[model samples]
Target chain A: MIRNEKKWLEARLEEWVGERLIAGDQAEAIRVYQGEKPERQWLSFFGLLVGVGALSVGIGTILVVSYNWERIPPVLRQLGFLLALAGVAEGMARSAGNRIAGPALGVIWVLLPLAGIGLWGQVYQLSGDAFTPLAVTLMLALPVVWIGRHASAAAAHALVFVWTIFVGVLEPGSWISMRGADALRTSWLAVVAVVLWAAMLHQTRRLSGPAVTLLLWMAFLVFMFTIAGNWTGFDIRHEGIHFVVAGALTMIFWVGEGVLGLSGRRVADVGWFATACFLYVLSFFHHGVGIGGGLETAGLYYAAVLSVAGVVCLARADMDEVAGAGGPHVARVLLALPWILSALLLGGDRHEAVGYLANFVLVVFCLYTMHSAVLRADRRRVNAAVFVLGLLMLTRIMDYFGSLLTSGSAFLVLGFLFLAMAYGLNRGRRHVLEQVERGGEA
Target chain B: MSGKWLRLTLVAQIIFFVAWAGVEEYGRANAVEFLLETRPVDPRDLLSGHYMTLRYTSLDPEGSVEGVRAAVRLEFEKEVTVDGRTWPVWHAVEKVEPGRVGDRSLSSTGGWADATVTGSRLDFGIDRFYFSEARKEELNSLRGGSFYVLATLGGDGTLRVKDLVWDREPPTP
Candidate 1:
């Protein structure tokens, strides 16, 4: 979901809740975190870690006393001590909110799963039997999911999304025709896509903006699917239309919720609806090539201009007001641009039309998003960076290898694309901040 | 069991077997071997990473009597056959023999296969044999061989191997 929409949803939820009582805005956690929070409301979360670390240390001490410390693996002993420090840090971070750099610690949270993997690996270190990594990862990630739910953020959510696929969903216990790594990568990507959409879905119920931000992700996935067409049987006419339809329906679902007032939660209902409609229109356009070429052309042309504009408007949208309202306006505009443009591009002989347009637009959108985030001093700009990079990688699908898949021209074009985007983001941030400081109602 | 019950049970058993077989076959990633008879001098996507967008000679959706090889001839009304019963597909030994050098993989009658398939290879670049990874293992068990694009669209399919090269052989350096 886009930063603005997330803000909009929170603002609206705040207003709605404030209508009845006082509302807290710790990065507007309720609007974003809802069911995402962990079940443990108790502060023992850190205590549990500390306790586990202490138990490990005590066990290690006894083992050392029972035999010689030198006989045991030094790595195991070092790990126990490190675990102790991790517990201390975690405990400290939770207690004093002043010292806790909440959002500043994203990768640490993501790598938390590796700790579990490590523990299991250590346990099964002997006799060459290593079957516990997956188990440990899942176990470790379970609490992390709870932690993410408690401490709502994009990074936290992305971490959980990664963990869930690796631990909860995919099967590695059995020997399949494909290797575990292949399954892991493929399923991991798919799970991330679904989780992102789910975030969109959750956000859409309140306001449309965040859901609209998710459309870029959808575009990214589409690009990946198309480029990775070798691994997939994702013929647009056959299977891809289903995803497009589902995406559209998802948008519509949010819109319907908002219209019914059931979505009193802060969501960009209108933005979500618009994004879905755009996806629906895009599906029609791509499929239109062999099926409805004329309608597809017209639809894509309309969508491209509108969606790109929507993202720009939303990224710059003021959210301190009725945050819910901000995202829908921007989302509607953003969804229209690419889908409509794609229709036009598809109609012509533009090679890698989706890549050129989507990549260009994504870079522009990323810069704009980062600029808005920086101007607002919102931490979402970090997420905007990741999202932009993701879109950039997805665009590589358009570049041919060796020749069709390895076009050197594409790499140069993309390399500059990133550099240019970085430049633009920096420049735009200055411009927006300057404008804001000049008393413009940014 | 009564006659009707027996018949119903028999039908159910038949359906169960067919469904089981169908799923097992479809779920499996099929490994087929192909060998090129005519080596195009120009490197056809030698370093193509990931999926090289493939074009098949038998992709003439319109029923054309043209020969299957990209550049070859087939005598008109040449009856090619697969004794599926006497020689099931497992027994079918396919290799790009000298005479078979430009013969496209085709049945007595030509058509397209319904299965979606992928290829695997052993050697690097041009010297690589294009077969599914599973099929490559199958080849390891057999003698050293070449690669081919399977001409498929039938009860089973046929292999048309070409572009023979060895792993130790250098490219046109």
Candidate 2:
């Protein structure tokens, strides 16, 4: 058992004993049994220290090699690098049984090859485009990451992967530079993000703790970028298709937790938050939405296929498993509402009506989120709900009074409303939290 | 992972690096030498450390062919000498018509190499010549001044920079 699991079990056991649901002796026995079992530490201090030391050594080595001392022949320098890599590999192999030193050596094992690739570019006076070499280095590092089974090595791998993609995008003659490839480029990035998330889902079955956390965070960051791209209007010609891809990605997050056993509360939270935020942005579009006319027929077909897949996944999923509360049927409807509204906007010309409907859905979703957060005693979600509501009120107030009143009066009204809302929300949040705490105690 | 698999992975990584270096070395050893006139476009690439981005005057096409991909023939006009080294300088030839052309050799007739015509630019993949940190300022100062690049074209049409010959003596590090 992990520390958190043990703590929860202990609390449950005390509650059961107090209610006479179980005898005190039985509770004591359960406690003793759990106490005797070995506790799994999520992170080892010694392992962290070793990992940091290894990173330092790796950076120091790269610095020394990159100095490009005139006296040392390029061939000799490369040979030195090969030797160092071999030594690190040997150390890693020998320390396989050591949980701390093995992964530490693995970090060096992964990094030396990348540094060596950079050194090769420097020595050969190769093109400054780092994409090819960085891509090659990442390919080589994958096996090391899988075999090392350490969070530090996995994190390093992910960092290099992201860097490689970044460099590739910026390289001359890439897809980004080519005309009419904007939608394709955005789609490719979205696909890459999905692949990372799929990898994270796979990792959950085999590993836990920081490795999974790092992967989740990296995947989520990329996913968020794709969502942000929809509004930033990078490719206006394919705006509708971008929304389809974003909607599909959001559905994957929702379905992954509810059906695919993605082991974290944050995945579901991310799904809800992204859906709510996207709808909230759409609500501001009072005029007709300007989805471009150059919609690819192929993209529409893809969107149809994705919509079918999403519906199937949602039908198979139990939202209660994700939401951790009853009334999962209602939760499913609420989650589907935004995507449905988005599709309506895409397929029809009634943009203003759909925009108004989106505003209504956003408010309802925020209220639902607050209720769920209170039920789960999640203070963070309650605060998030309050923040979103406050933003909505502020935007609406600015819209109503911007031209109706003088600048000074408008400022005074906005300031007063802001302060009043902040005070009211704070009090409401505190009362809800107090009720939740009391319920838990009871 | 099993010890056997881990050792195999380690060996494979070493082989990957060795193979890359070995391929470049082979290309360098067998490549035929040529001279090309280049002007520095960008002084440095921060991502790949210090390197001078070179724009080949010969490879710049006359009209816009943005986003067009085709195989291009390189034609050499004359021999140029810089600091006592003489070699043929490449000139821009017409892009190869894929099916209409009968012979592949016609595309690479007497000149050094072939390059992919991508977008509006001809990519030799050797456009950037890396320099040491001490020579950064010297290279930056060579902007707008033509320099001779001693490049080699391998059998596979890959071009590698062998050396850079400046019109005047470069400053000592």
Candidate 3:
């Protein structure tokens, strides 16, 4: 345990730093590391790709068969395969990054990026929902970021992100049903969102920013649809203004980066982080006061402005000395006071703000926070908080949509589809391993 | 496996388990799934707790009907085929044998009705089984027919639907 480092425990890191440091023949060292043949490791990568591909197929079959997708278009099935392949490619690419597949990065990159982009364009085009705008931005940005990290994984992550976005956001309508008054009370979407939050936390989870952006947009879709029809609908009149303002601020952040010569991705990162926070705090404020003050109020506007500013600063610079572990935790702090006041001030009074539009926005804000929190990984409370919020939203959705919906059958089918997938995935993996072991012994 | 590897796998397993368990438990406890099924009931007679929902075998895409007339004609090329249309599902034809499929039924939830079905062709059930009484009536008019439609176990473990049937079949008595 003490020997985890190369030298003694008390060895000066600076004293040995130069040995591996780039002082001597940096070019030759790069060349040698790059030149080493990675054929053996290539075989291991192929094995991983095979495992993931087979598992995905086996799992997909169980779901499609159990659901009887006689009516589902084949294009969707093709879309699913594209996603699975991307995941496999990402794993292979990550392996390649450690100098594993010497020359084959050439071959892998060619096939992987093409498949990845093709899938991305198709899936995004297929849905074209409110969330589509957000997902497309992230998907396009990711492969570039992945290429920076490792070309293969980036391609794969980008590809997988596209499909997950398509599946989670675009396809098969949401089972979420919430009354106008209790829209934030509890909805099935909230439940699924919470579960997804938890699942992300427990896995060695990574959020391809685009993937999280897509999901956040998905949560936001409920609001978009709720007040979608009329100019006077609660979401359109109230929260939509705020989202537009946030979008403007995001664009400003983009413009600022171009003008001031600042970082692009970080600017985008901070903008997303800030938008999520503003939504979080707004949820609390509206929750406290059934009907919040208009955007004309200086105090609310100042807080909003500062929240965006703080995230921008944090995203641009290392905020470790100032805020430590950065945007998510700070966002939580800013939101905590309002949440407390909301509960204490409102108690359990049932009222209407043009039918609880304000509260629904807050619900969306909280869901977004939980999503961002999972990506940042250290903040565990946000995950729990979102799950509870989701449970609450389910009640509202069912109450509102219950009368309007055909039956609870859609929700039931969704429930079964997920259950079967989980059961099948685990079983299928074990079965594959057993077959492998028997073959190895042979 | 290494300790780290085992821990990671265990965590994944826990996450997957919790997700499925949440969906299943929530569905059963809340009757969320039951509320989602397609329940057929007359709009005039429909209410939350009243009226057994009816689903027709002739209407369902995947159904198996037993003991019908042998030569009951087949037409597969049209969409939205229901009663009283010029080419309705069943007319005055030589009675034929049963078909190989049965229409499945589930409980209904409230909403504006989308489409309407008129005149019965073939219906299936266990206790509510009517072998063509050659009479027709509105489903809601049946006495004591107001009840929540629920699933029941047949002789085997397969599903059996029991509710109300408004139209009478001819071969009964």
Candidate 4:
């Protein structure tokens, strides 16, 4: 069940208690009754352990078979693979009703199909176009994914998406001259296609939040990695195709979220906003400050164009949020401010000034995220914000210590600071919750 | 008992695995063996696992070849002496530039006849050799010099490396 649905139910129950329609004890009983029923609670803990143990054993057996593959006769080798595949299939069938073991076996079973593909590829000496085997494996494992609707199925699906992206980006081909730029474009579009499918599945209640979230994040990272590789000089002249495709995807997803009236739209919005700002900052570092180097005019022009696209996406997403929430979102405004500042500072001669401003914006954005998460009672959001803040702090400290760390004392200071940050984050979570409860806002 | 469809799917998966493996094994069992000259690549990688990065000089297509599939036939000498032993020698028969193949001359079989030229190498499919990890050191020591890959070549141009040969002999098991 979605967290929002659970919260809405709790609030209605609280209202019933306030109205005194029934005794408080009755309300409490209802709350307890409405709690999420564990799917086969008895099979949870111990079954999970057994399932994991089975997976480990399966892995060991496969490894042993593969290791002694050459020693076995060719026909026996084929027999061994068939036997192992059947063994896993039987295990999966037996545990079909088991919540823990079913998924575990499903996940373990995915490897068998992949192993079969690799085994045959080895035997027949298939060509090294990595995508072919992966595609074949995906086809082979489709039944497992279809029948096993659990974490294992989700993982198998994720592997397919990841492998597809990997093949698109790194597959050796004549497009090698593009150094994956061509492939990156194709892969990013593939991500968009998958995400759209996931979104539709989610709307139909066939896909889980974790699955959709994983797809969205993977899509974002795949695009980001492509751009990040050539951030200083991502030539839109030759390589702008992927950025345009990514930008279109970002807009489509944002619009689709609004049209579908889906929850967790903020994840996509924030991801796009963050990616935009990242590109803008990288551009400013190259075009504005020219720190560590500068880009040619064409590169700068491409960066400027991408930044505009980012602004458009952020504005549309923010407007949608405001329209729904009945007010301007402070977090959205803060996230947008950095891009504005970077745009203004673009081509400026002030390197130190822009650098400091970008750092300040990063810290503020992190705090805003953490503070809003507290007000909203979202622990995952809070953790994500804290992680970003911690990462930025570590990077900044490391940069300073790069030249200053000549002795053990500097290392000691760094270690102590890391521990202190951890402790502070724990305390800060409590303090933020208490402050929000006291009607305070960050 | 499990859901019938789930059970059916499992059985289907098993059948698929068996059929796939059976076909591959059949091909390998019937394939004719060919040898390709190989050289050591990356000392660190050679020692890292049972697998070694392999390169075949013949597979590296020289000049330009144009076509979705680069077609080259293997020219085999009936017999040749290697060291003190007589063995069959087979190598990819790459015509430096097939004039008729490039210039509007079409073959009914759609063979290498109408193929253009480019620099991309033919994927001989023998780029890697895998063995048991226990023999990591043994494989690593072979990095000392050039070696020959005794591989099976299928009718449809599939290549599988079967054994590594040094000094015109397969390394002792």
Positional deviation of A185 in candidate 3, in angstroms? 5.4
Candidate 4 deviant stretches above 4 angstroms: A1-22, A26-112, A122-125, A147-256, A264-306, A315-372, A382-442, B42-50, B59-66, B75-89, B94-119, B167-173
TM-score of each: 0.34, 0.53, 0.25, 0.57
C-alpha RMSD by candidate, in order: 18.7, 12.8, 22.0, 10.5
Between candidates 1 and 2, name the one with more favorable DockQ: 2
Per-prediction DockQ comes to 0.02, 0.25, 0.04, 0.25
Output the lDDT of residue A41, model 3. 35
The TM-score ranking, best first, is: 4, 2, 1, 3
Q: Rate the local accuracy (lDDT) of all candidates.
A: 0.37, 0.65, 0.36, 0.55
lDDT of 3 by residue, A137-159 (tens): 34433433333344333434434
- Decide which is better by DockQ, 1 or 3: 3
True contacts kept of each: 0.00, 0.36, 0.00, 0.34
Candidate 3 lDDT, B20-134, residue by residue in tens: 3344334334321111122354432211112233443332333322332222222222222113322112111222333422432222221111111112333222112211111
**Residue A208, candidate 1: C-alpha displacement in angstroms:** 17
In model 3, where do residues sit more than 4 Å from their true spots?
A1-17, A20-173, A177-195, A198-240, A244-442, B1-173
